[model samples]
Target: MDAVPLLRISRPHRLSEEVGAVLEKHIRSGEFGPGEKLPAEARLAEQFAVSRAVVREAIARLKADGLLESRQGSGVYVAQCLGAGVFRMAAGVRGEAHPIEDIFELRLIIEVAAAERAALRRTPADVEAIEAALARMDEAVALSADGVRADDDFHCAIASASGNPLIGRFVAFVSHEFSASRAPTWSREGIVRGLAGAAQDEHRAVHAAIVAGDPAAARRAARQHLLRAARRLGVVLAAPPGARGEDMDEETS
Candidate 1:
């Protein structure tokens, strides 16, 4: 019944994200405390000067982030626990100039270790899945596509093969967070070909080491691939723990 402070969205791109951020800020600031019901979707949409569909998307994202919950025959309310103890990509991180670079640093920590375990624990079927994802990437590259999904699938396969479900989940989460970062890099026409080609080669190196069941080599390969990926995006990652601090000369296929 009181006046709402939701601002009208001006930018067209990533409408849902903007709306979600506004609502999340309110929640975090205690304006919408735990168990407090939010305004109806239609009302929120009108306040934001956006469609109901956009409001729905924003709500869904908040739900996924554990900031909100729904009740049967009732509207959405702020979550009671507010995702306590859960690992979340902070809102500030996503707003940074190279947010994905920070995520890449996380991947270097999680995925490099996962790749080593995958080489040790992967079964024949796991190898098949990894190869299948690799094939899809190859097809996308040959067709001059960005292959972002295929690239994600390739890393996820290795995560699955790690024999640790927690590692798999964390890898998938970080990968999702960093996905938007790839679009800009691929959107550039002049470098897409070279970038995709180099990426594919690095992927092959990782796959080869895993297929050979060589844990140390797999670790090395995975680290090199992620480091090279950051380079392709014009990002420089500070060497994470256990990294050999390899230079550009060492990132060969």
Candidate 2:
């Protein structure tokens, strides 16, 4: 009988992520090639010096991500990875590789600059597009429905208004990534009173600055809006994506 392969985690900080990363690395490296069964939870728990619960959570994450699979009564096995190599080289999970704070920081840099450029370059058509998108976003937020798609349209319109396909494309990509990690942001805890109204006001400010062709004000408004949004999201991100945080209970109601 052959012994099960197991690896030890180095740093204990962010245990589930560390464990997940290690396992991910293994599957990606072909050490546990496609269709190879992974060691049982008990053995993995012993190797990592973590509890079975943590191991279960880590495995569950991989399975949810389409990286691994569990058969009926059989152990877990690696999934047939198609773009595994590209994904490994490109980026990691937003919640795991980098804190959600970095996502907001990225928006502060790219979206704010996009607004500034849009103010200088926006044509009549672009302005009209942005205005329409903003109106839809306002309605969606007011209804307390998930405004993520409308919010995306509003930001992407700004990028398109900049008259740069590259900027628009990049903004589109970033928007997808950001929402992938933090969709339905309006539903998070500690969102504060009238969050929808506040966000609408900020969007209007950005739109007004662009419409007035005031590049500086456009940048400033975009900055202030992202800063407020980051603060609210920071609360949600106090926990990892899809999990609850300690402080959330007080703010939940």
Residue 197 displacement (Å), model 1: 0.7
TM-score of each: 0.60, 0.54
Quick one: best lDDT, which candidate? 1
Best by TM-score: 1
lDDT of candidate 1 at residue 220, scale 0 to 100: 88
Candidate 1 per-residue lDDT, tens place, 86-145, comes to 455776664444467777877878888999999999999889989998998788767776
**Model 2, 1-253: lDDT tens per residue?**
9998889769656788889989988875559887789999999999999999889989988887667888998988887541232232124644455556767767767898999999999999889889988888777665666676677778888998998877875675456555543363555331335665677889999999999999989988887787667665554323234533423442242
What's the true lDDT of residue 193 in model 1? 47
Model 1: pairs clashing at backbone N, Cα or C within 3 Å: none
TM-score of structure candidate 1: 0.60
Instruction: List ranges where model 1 is wrong by over 4 Å.
Output: 1-87, 92-98, 184-192, 240-253
RMSD to the true structure for each prediction, in A, is: 14.8, 17.1
